[model samples]
Target: MLLTDTHTHLYYETDDVKRAELVQRCKYNNIGRLFLPNVDAASVAMVYSLESSFPDLCYPMLGLHPCSVKENWEAELAAIKQAIHQHEIFAIGEIGIDLYWDKTFLAEQLQAFKQQIAWAKSLKLPIVIHCRDAFDEVYDVLLQEKGDDLRGIFHCFSGTVEQANKITDLGFYLGIGGVVTYKNAGLDKVVAQVSLNHLVLETDSPYLAPAPYRGKPNESSYLIYIAQKVAELHQTDLETVANITTENSKRIFGV
Candidate 1:
């Protein structure tokens, strides 16, 4: 079965020479699809250019990442809107509130996030949430703004079964990543309790690679590592994990 990496940032700060080799390794590892999320206006061109060059392999999503919320966030939001109007992006994402690193612009981040969620609904696209140490704060915004139209995956989900149930009840998929394979990630309980339909596989690559590759630059090929761990936890085979996650991703991104 073909595996799909539902979340990856292959072009982020990547060297051209290594990019060539990295993609070859992905092919060898059975990864056929890679979803690239836009981080900011600065990275949008690169993300789309990568998608254009590898249309058969890379798919692009356009949205300002949560970490990118800053003083010029309004202008950045306008740029994101213009890009949405101009091109055919899969979804609005890598978007959400992040309170862990800094809370200086938490308010602005929420505003940008909800505004983008509304935009995603207007565009008839899903969202890709990037919650970190702020699930409660993020969920507050979601509870207010989310509706049948505002649906997508909670990328890099690491939460309680209750939280997982809450997200899944909203018809959003949980993005399981390298954290699942860690010895003490705490994702094991959530993965075991959540059904396959509410789950999607990802690496958030060039970032959180699974065990053995932990503490190193992640790649799409490492998606299989996370998928394999999910399979083992769910007491199924690797292909089963790949198949269900592929279907779940298609449902969310409409790819």
Candidate 2:
């Protein structure tokens, strides 16, 4: 069964150069595609480098992460725009309101988020959201700003069923990651009720590792455990889980 990790940061500047080998491991484990997202101006080069090195296997996204929002948000946004123009990005992603970490730039984050959304809309591209602890606010933005032009995935979706319904209503898909395999993840209930059409597999690697490897750094190879857990939760077979999630991924990413 083939799986796709729709969210992952395999090209961290501080990360070791073992990422290429990690990609090999993911291929060995059937996690064939990698969707790489940029955090800010600093990450554009790295995001492109990895995508350039593995064009057929790895895809890149141009977006400013919520955590990277700050006083110089305009400059950062300009840089993100530059990346979009400089490379063929897969989507405008890892972009959304994240109030959990710091609210100092919440206002700026909101503005930047909307700007990116409009930019993506103008380009006729889908977005990949990174919503963390600001579901209501994020949902509000989608409702207010999306307006049929916006469509994408909610990365690392660990929300209530009501939230899932709302997001998909906006023509988006949920990015279920290794978090679903955790003991107290609470995603089993979510996936049990949500249809396979609304779900897509992701590892969010170098983060949110699954149950068997919960404490370890995540990688695409661990997506099989996530797919298994999802299949079991949805009362279906592994192949069905892999196939549908992959199709959902392809639909959202246009790949």
Candidate 3:
């Protein structure tokens, strides 16, 4: 069974020994593909370094995360854009409106999100969104920019069935992660209701670890747990979940 973590920040683990252990764990768990989305200019190098170290296992994506949209967001975006040009990226994201942490930069966040969407469109690449508490705002922008060219994954989607429909209708895949394993996250219910055709798996590592490790640091290796939960929710086998979700990742990343 080959599983794909459509979103992860495994690059954050810089210790070579520990990082190798993380990758080895992923391999042991059959998590063959890991997509890394850099949050800002500073993280671009980290993302690329991990990808280079595991050329066949890690894929890199570039974008200005909404939470990173500070006063100097323009400069950050410029740096990320320059980096995007210098290397091959599978997607332009973990970008979207995130109003959960602070509402101070809502306007800036919107601008950054839209700008990154434009970058994805221009590059003919998919986007990976990080919607927090601004799904309405993000959905509105996506509606405005709706087209054949706009397509990507809604990373770490923990929304309602209605919202899931809205995203899938836009040709975007719903990125399910460790949250689904939470006893009360209600994401399992949503996943059970939605078809696997419009769904993908992720870990969003260094955060949102699944149950049995909920309060600990998350890693791509734990993706097997998330995949197992998804398989349980869908009433299917692990191999089926792995096959379908990995194929969906390939569809989105074109890799």
Which one is best on lDDT?
Answer: 3
Question: In candidate 3, residue 62 scores what lDDT?
Answer: 92
Candidate 2 weakest lDDT stretch, 10 residues: 11-20
Indicate whether candidate 2 or candidate 3 has the larger lDDT: 3
The sequence of per-residue lDDT tens digits that candidate 3 reaches over residues 176-242 is: 9898999987989999999999999999998999988999999989998998998998899999999
Model 2 residue runs over 4 Å out of place are 13-17
TM-scores of all models? 0.97, 0.96, 0.99
Residue range 1-255, candidate 1, lDDT tens digits: 888888898987457777878888889989998998989988888888787777899888989888999999999989878887787888898899998899999999999998999889898999999999999998988889867888998999999999999888888899999999888888887799889889988888888889989999888888878888888888999989888889888888888
Q: How many residue pairs clash in each candidate?
A: 0, 0, 0
Residue pairs with colliding backbones in model 2 are none
- Model 3 off-target regions past 4 Å? none
lDDT of each: 0.88, 0.87, 0.94
